[model samples]
Target: MEIAPGIYSMTQRKGAYVHAFLLDDGDGLTLVDTLYDTDAHRVLAELDQIGKSVSDIKHIVMTHCHRSHLGGLALLKERSGAPVYAHQWEADLIAGERKQQPVAWRPYAPVRVWPLQIALNLGVARHPPATVDHFVQEGDQVGPLRVVACPGHSPGHLSFWWEQRRLLIAGDAICTWPSLMLGWRGFTLNPTQHRASVRRLAEFDSQILCVGHGEPLASDAAQAIRAALPSLDR
Candidate 1:
């Protein structure tokens, strides 16, 4: 689905409605996160729907190293020959050089995500590993996005801003599924960092909010984020 003028949203039912974005800036395509299918059939189908092909994708960027988001990365990179970008802290994990640091074993609220928490704690259901071609930091541009380092869910978790479109691709720093919250409580590695990061995200004048999980918020996005801020302290 084209959520914005040139941004396409692709979602997979598994992995907590894991969502990805495909951007067309009239300069080929840039993919943000690949849903939970290792084969990448869904992403490929989206490209087809948009009347594009894998060759049209010029950059493959990652928000973090979580399995739900990295599933199609390896296959997409090989087929498109697109350079993959991510934060340095997450590079080794993406490359399979190291395991992702686990989260707490104790379950948190919104019970639907408990299974995922268990899976992560056990290091089960790993994604196909792929090498990152470059490491991006805050203020760096990846295609049409301005990288915003949002660490909390993970040390290197990231979000992106498209100033021209007033769009915020907020990764897992915020979720709208099963009710909006700071993030999945059990999966957050550092609540202090996450809280601070979300505060920063809320500062943007985002008209459209695309998250790692759940449908995109097309209007009043910035206000919605602001409304959720107080909950972080609860």
Candidate 2:
């Protein structure tokens, strides 16, 4: 999905399913989030479909430090030698300065427990231990993308915004999947912070929302977020 002229959403096929975005900045590509190791080959395949090779990726901006989001970083970095950018807080966790925690809003059903844990242990549900090359604060500019600090899901969680196109690449700040109404379960540092971040994002007049899960929204993204707010409490 095209969040703007050069941005494209690259969804990974996983049990929970995750998405990453690609930004073709006229010169090269900037990847927003790299899927898990299990999905690394798929990400490479997708890149091939777009006429890009792994080596063509110049930079990678991580939305947060989650296994599903940063699992393939080591492999991708080895292939492309691209620099990884992340918020300072997340950078700490990714770099082993802090211990990673589980998400808070997991579904109550018992069916997913063991399998989820297995995936986590196998490095398919969380990021493989690694380091970031660049630590970003709230207002950092990544090529043409602007980093919007949206912490709540994690201390350093962030979203990317393209002011020129009114596009927002919301990582897990908001998910499009209705099944994850309460927000992504398994590991969330703070629910209250996450909600506040969502509200903050709603204030932005973005025309497109390319979230981490579910379908992408075109135009009136703020309205869609408003409509989803009520269900978040369910």
Candidate 3:
């Protein structure tokens, strides 16, 4: 789905479904997050749907360091030769400085049964660490998008917000699902920090909320976030 004029959300299936945004900056396309390695072909196929090729992806921006988010980095780098951009703190994880942690979920979570969930957590033990071509801090600009630091899911988690366009690419800062569901079931490095990140996002006036795991919220996104604030406090 085209979220804006040149921005598109490529929804892909892994353990659970996930969405990665594609932004065309006229020079080349910028991929928000790379899908899982196993789903690379599917992702490439989806890119084809928009008349884009893997080689057309000039920059790979990671929202965080989760394997599900960076699993396809090696393959994408092999194909696109694009510089991978990530937060300085996450650069080590992305570059193999720190070991990628195992994915663990509460036994009562909804997606444990899915084979990909186990595979992603256990099967892919190590991610191919790559160097960051560009390290971004909060308030930096990537093309026309502004970088916003919202670290809670990971120490270096970041989101891209296009203030002029009222577009926000929130990387798991907040999800369409309930906070408890995400805390107990979804992937999070730190729940306390995540809550803070959510609160920080509320301060920004955004028209769209593009999360890593659900459909994009196009209407009253800021209000929706305000309503979800109480849940985070609990």
Candidate 4:
């Protein structure tokens, strides 16, 4: 689905309707995440439908190293030969040098995620490891995105802002799945950091919002994010 001009949102049933975005800034395609398929068939289909090929994917950017988002990283990187960019904190994990830091096993408000939390704690269902070619920090530009370091979901969690389009690519910092939320409580490593991150995300005058999970918010995106701010307190 084209959530906005030049931005296409791709979703998968696995990983709680996990989403990835394909961005065309005219230079070439820049993929936000790879979705929840190891073969990357879904993403490839989307590209084919748009008459684009893997080589057109000039940059592949990662929001974090979570398994749900990393499934197609290796395949896409190998096919597109695009340099992968992520935060420094997630480099080792992305490279398979270390497993992701686990989250609490206890059930939180969105109990549906408990199973996933348990899977992470047990280090099960790992994704194919891929190398990160570059480490991006806040203010750094990757394609048309301005990297925003929004930790708390994990130490190196990131979000992206496209000032040109007033778009915010909020990874797990905010979720619209099950319902709009300030990230899943059970998986949140640091509530304080997540809270601050959401607060900062809400400040963006985003007219469109794309998240790590759930459908893209096409309108009143900033207003919706601000409205969900009180959830951070709970």
Using all chains and alpha carbons, the TM-scores for the candidates as numbered come to 0.98, 0.84, 0.83, 0.98
Error of 3 at 36 (Å): 1.3
- For residue 56, what is the lDDT in candidate 4? 99
Q: 2 or 3, which is superior by lDDT? A: 2
- TM-score attained by model 2: 0.84
Q: On a 0 to 100 scale, what is the lDDT of residue 122 in model 1?
A: 85
Q: What TM-score would you give candidate 1 relative to the actual structure?
A: 0.98
> Candidate 2 residues 67-166, lDDT tens each?
6677777778778899989988788777656656644333542334336544554543345566789999788998768999988778888898988878
Q: Give stretches of model 1 more than 4 Å off.
A: none
Segments of candidate 2 deviating more than 4 angstroms: 1-4, 96-98, 105-127, 179-182, 232-234
Could you tell me the TM-score of candidate 3? 0.83
Model 3 misplaced stretches (Cα beyond 4 Å): 101-125, 177-186
Worst 10 residues of 2 by lDDT: 104-113
Q: Compose the digit string of candidate 4's lDDT tens values, residues 80-110.
A: 9999999999988988999779899799968
> Would you list the rank order by lDDT, best first?
1, 4, 2, 3
Candidate 3 residue lDDT tens string, 1-234: 787678787665553456688888788888898765644665687688889889888888888877667767778877889988889888888877876554554443445434544564664556676778899988887766788998767788899987776878887676553221223334556778877777888877988878877677876778877776786655
In model 4, what are the clashing residue pairs, if there are any? none
